[model samples]
Target chain A: MLVHAGNSRGAMRGERLCPAEVKRGLLDGNPWQADPSLANLSGVADALAGNGPAHRIIIDATASGEVADYHAHWLEQGIHVVTACKLGSGTTLERWRAINDAVARGNARYGDSATVGAGLPLLRNIRDLQAGGDTIHSIAGVLSGSLAWLFNHYDGQQPFSQLVLQAKDAGYTEPDPREDLSGDDVRRKILILARAAGVPLASDEVAVDSLLELAADGASADAGLEALDAPMAERFEAASAAGAQLGFIARLQDGRARVGLERLDATHPLAGGAGTDNRVAIWSDRYCDQPLVIQGPGAGAGVTAAGLLDDALRIARSTPD
Target chain B: MLVHAGNSRGAMRGERLCPAEVKRGLLDGNPWQADPSLANLSGVADALAGNGPAHRIIIDATASGEVADYHAHWLEQGIHVVTACKLGSGTTLERWRAINDAVARGNARYGDSATVGAGLPLLRNIRDLQAGGDTIHSIAGVLSGSLAWLFNHYDGQQPFSQLVLQAKDAGYTEPDPREDLSGDDVRRKILILARAAGVPLASDEVAVDSLLELAADGASADAGLEALDAPMAERFEAASAAGAQLGFIARLQDGRARVGLERLDATHPLAGGAGTDNRVAIWSDRYCDQPLVIQGPGAGAGVTAAGLLDDALRIARSTPD
Candidate 1:
């Protein structure tokens, strides 16, 4: 049953967006929702609300701020939420607490399985560990798929600039590339993971050692890419000489979160990944000696879709038909 | 809310035992009635049935055949089950299927989290992976905490039999130490894991490579411990010379479950464990590149108690108060 469909870009709404039309529309980019205005997003919520009770909303949009606001509202209305957006869960400690409180108040489930590790069960694992009476001491990982791919391949073999350009061309990095290089995404992921481990952390609280400072002000993508070569080359060269690999690592420990590039030895848990793989090692009271590690492709459209569906199916199975 | 309590050893019935009393009783072993005979087991069930419609049974007994039989009956009565017994989940495929059918028919939850990997989330992880549409290619690990401790400590520096004796003394192994060496527990665990991964495997169907063959039939504990020295010495020496550590590994792959001794390097997921720690690595499509690895203390009285409570609390939270 198609309840309601609205696209921000093109004029498609109500009668025009049947099940078939919506399916075809989602096949490509968000032509209908290029600029997801507040009216368009609220239109989605209003349509879902009109459908009565027991409705589930799958938020695949990355606008965490707007999506989280709607998520809180919908959850308060006893509607379930499954999201791939980290911003909803990763924005601020206050918002995080609000979402949780809303879900509790309405007895709704908020599925954030795809928010951190794509389709991997990193958040769920952390939650289960906590439920099992395991005190999670720390979590460290290479979280960003784009950053992991770039670092894993950028061993001073070729100019680091070329790899950054190649990664951008491969659709691995954000279009601006600066967004990924800024370390904000990794910081958000670390905070998300930290929250899952029972740590309520605000966005600005995380200490992010970014590589974006190397890029000069008002530099274009090409200029920024070229400027990063010298510094990155030195970092990679030093790491190799020390028998260590350079990894963009995120660590949450002792009530603090840190994200930065680190020199990891071969034996380190986060030291291995082929391409765009996110590997996390969680050290806890129960898993104290050898941390529980989960590694896999952390990003990509296919995996994100799988994660969203997985969360939806989970809610469906648990919710009464 | 003291419902009922009984030990197979003595006549302590009709009066409900308090939490402290039950703790004291468990300290000495199962003695409320010594032998968990069929009639006594049935009587316990009957007493619980008299309580009310919605009842949850926590079976901490090791009597696989009997507990599973009763688990089916209780579940059919709409009574939930939280258990630390592997037999209920690890028995023959037919019995396993029967229990599952009972759970489904009664719409009752079966808590099997503590059955394998002691308190670790091995079974749950496998189930979640399957539910998330990820195909598990294979699973391999050091599942037995007693064996993990034994192998981890035994480096040919001291007599292997002495380490076995120490492990037994520390309450790490089954009373008959032969049970640990027999690989039956590991086989059951592998079968439990394989079933959780969507493979309906019979208990006997597993190709378990046993170490018990070294001990003569009807040998005493001392005699068996003595007989194990020479073969174990040779094995450890060989493993050391080859620069590999010996691990009692359980593997389920290509629709086959195997349990036996194998050599593992430091890089192996199951290689590192201080004392009675169980480590597992799961390979699936989502986690295809590098296996999802979980490591922790696999066995201990305190840890097992924690697992049972954890499972019970999970069931309690899910079920209506």
Candidate 2:
């Protein structure tokens, strides 16, 4: 019941812009408008023309590489930010020390419940895992539900092509399902996770030994996904018969980062998870003398929507300052 | 990587005082001695050699009801205190506000994190919920794990024949777990929730419906517990079968307060939680579309300990002002 606490202390929460005051603040030697990145801030500036201040701002750039400009402008303006730059080819939704550093350096506040750790239990685990004395040695996840379902029944006996086509029709895969099958998304998620565990590594830095076809690289975000209509089960029948199920594993050891495309049996935590649910195993030195396992819905538009809302709720509930 | 932002802030995070400091604080002006029910504090008093300006004494008597005496005794000795007796509750944790009030009242900054939102999730939520047109309807949660597990699983079905025994097995039920299960713990929790929601509420005014077996009126903590245990499960199981889960719910409705044991289904959002996980569900008038949920390890040796440490960390991380 603690989504957002009622504003018992409303006056202290967000800035109540008095147009006169904001204009004054703007002219009071804070030359933020000169920054090219803030050209979009014209909306905020125009809004401040009257006696007012902007309580918050949101920007979703169509591209990447804009984080530096955004952070610099805000830092100079002494602003609080909650931005979700892309996954950086690593983790999806997580806060490593880099975030904490940003919070400190800017003398600003941040709560990005959206970008990382939607409602699915990623960020909170990282934020509070130490409480359980749990350290994460490995994190194996079924991040893409479509992939999990496709690979589960495919077993390489069926042409992955037909199975992927079936998955597309079932709405299990994204409209462009390539992201779900290529293992790149999984690698990015692993990177986000490693950073959360205090492992200093980038998503691209992790060596990914993928099980997907190398020819799939020719596909774009939207177009190439239809390539899965070919025969696929015939490709993996023998491996499937060997009690091997395709599972993507992200592992960290002795400062080396790696992603494994392996066959996990039913005994594996990944294989044992019921349904298309996402299961994650965190191996750490600190967890109560064993590994910490967190499992839940890994996919579904509804679940992702809920996760976004969860982030919204988290943002809604935290003190902006 | 986020660790050494700077020593400028880290020094404040060291809430872990040496034994000498603890002894010194206890003896300085005998803060506890001034409280009516508190044991004498002379042992500490005798140990402190005359020190610098009389120490600032802060006594938190939210539970003990000793606020008035705490301030009076310390104030008379030219030692200062900021207490619930004089300043309001939020002022105790609102660092800037607390310091301002302490200086204004000519008292030492007196506070313990226990009384307020503890780790400020309440305050943070309050800040967030208010920002996005949100009003709280009800707050229901298992504020205490011991009481929740006791009520959920402890009755005759698994009765050990005693509340204390059950709680001890669960941790922190009290010298008498009966007090916890009897609705008082949830009542206090409701009061806090109400206060967080900005409702003017008092603990006694909370409308609590206790489910203990009325016929099994206590002769002793253990004896009455066995008599009380039998019917509890059918009540919970029936709720679960009907697509609901059990939770000790604290509700704030229209400025009045009350708490009850709830058999809430998935619609209630408090369902599906397994064990010892604490949740706050706020159905607000503001966010009319849906209720907001904030779930976490609410009460625990580890979670709360992390919370306390987070408080210490916040202090260490903030500017000294």
Candidate 3:
């Protein structure tokens, strides 16, 4: 069932009913085929013919929200759809409503296992604690690994070059590391965490100060890390000597959410942090007393690959689809 | 539909499953249905037969392993069971298989949301981040607020009793903080985090070292605290000059987990972490250039309560029924 489709794109088109195709798909274990295609939503709808061997359809979208729009066509097929949208889970309550309606209409299960996109598994953790009626006093941690690394080199004016290079050397930066340096990366992550924490929020609500100096020219994703590096090294050196390390943090309290982007001096608790680690802690209520905390590494190939493997195993062990 | 039966143990068994009773249960929206009025598991099963009305179920066990046996029955139904008997999420792959099977066969979802008991949400965050292939590189943190608190107070030949009391006053210890000081609580939480990060582990595999000193009789959960109070004061009085602090750290790496119970001196980054504050960090491979770090207030009702509320809201917003 493992089809080597040659790496360009692995997609799940909406139940574009092609019994023969489905047979091939299921046989190929191209589970993505059961999902709606990104292009031409109507085309995918028209293709779905009838119930095929695929009962579960998981849409692993570039942005988890993409698959959310196809609840209608998916419901009639009775094929459950699980998504890992990058946006906050609540952003599309309207779409989720469609899902709830689809469930009511005898469709399939709809879940967003990947809404927050990697690192600390915030949503899942909150759900587990809630089952026990545990009180949560606060949730605090480093939400962005990229920003932390970017700031690590900021000695007020190291030109941010040496830092970016160091981050690159350390593998903290991505092939395109700017995304990691930009405040956007951690901001979205913490938003996902906050949403799971049950904090009603919009991404804008969390303040973000970029870890990398912005390019005046304003290049897009295509610019990659080039724009990020060429600038800022000159301005970041001063902060590094006094022993200030960069770390991005997200915090939640009574009806409020805040992001902490600061320089941690040698005395600061986080100053000694090594690289690209993110932590989310919940001040838990209910057990004996004082809040309970959970902390850990926030990013990497091994962990993420294992996480997906866990999801795949979970799916395999679940419905047998 | 709110059933106004007498709130007694006997009433649980005698409870009728009439339309009125169903209405009451629906109106209350409680997730658990417990009492002695039923003949067998079928009675509990029958009570749960209503269609489409969303609800919450909380199963609180009196002791170890009691809840798991009962839950195996619930697993046959569509209930998404969360329990402590399975303990932390990282119990075993074999256990994970059973739970996953139940979730699949029951056409349900299963998560040990409260696996770490009072600790903050761990699995939820990992689950939510499953979409974009974000990875977890390393996990290390000060897991026990109470232990951290106790460590803060100890300077000399501090009996654990005085320190526990000091933690209690500082809002670091719970009503009974012995669970934390004993190391079991922190170990369980670390297991949960490890599993969420996709490690297949068991709590027994973790090496735990208790920081509690043996009292006149023994270091029990209750009496131990009383004996602990005296030396703690002197420890704090003595340490204040040296500018040191006590902290409890839980770490998971290379499939192994351990804890550090220490008195960090002045010059140590973790020194002087006041009150219930906790700091956690991770070293990730994705950001190979640097290790990521996260730190924050690791204890308190306000923070924990917020975490609980977050879990409740995530459930309300998603598929936690």
Q: Give the TM-score of chain A in candidate 3.
A: 0.64
User: For residue A293, what is the lDDT in candidate 1?
Assistant: 72
Give the per-residue lDDT digits (tens) of candidate 2, residues A1-321. Answer: 111111111111123435444334344423431232333432332322333333333322112443424443453343444434334224422334444565667554453433432234465556555443445566656655566666656654455666767888888775766666667766766666676677778556778765455445566443344344332333355446876666556666666677755667643545533335455655554322223444444654444444444444454345342
Return the top candidate by lDDT.
Answer: 1
Best by DockQ: 1
Q: Which ten residues in a row have the lowest lDDT in candidate 2 chain A?
A: A3-12
Decoy 3 TM-score against native: 0.54
Ranking by lDDT: 1, 3, 2
- In model 2, the fraction of reference contacts reproduced equals 0.00
Residue clash pairs of candidate 1: A8-A32, A9-A32, B7-B32, B7-B33, B8-B33, B8-B34, B9-B31, B9-B33, B9-B34
Q: Is candidate 2 or candidate 3 better by TM-score?
A: 2
* Clash statistics: count for each candidate: 9, 46, 107
TM-score of each: 0.82, 0.56, 0.54
Docking class of 2: incorrect
Q: Pick the candidate with the highest TM-score.
A: 1
Error of 1 at B259 (Å): 2.2
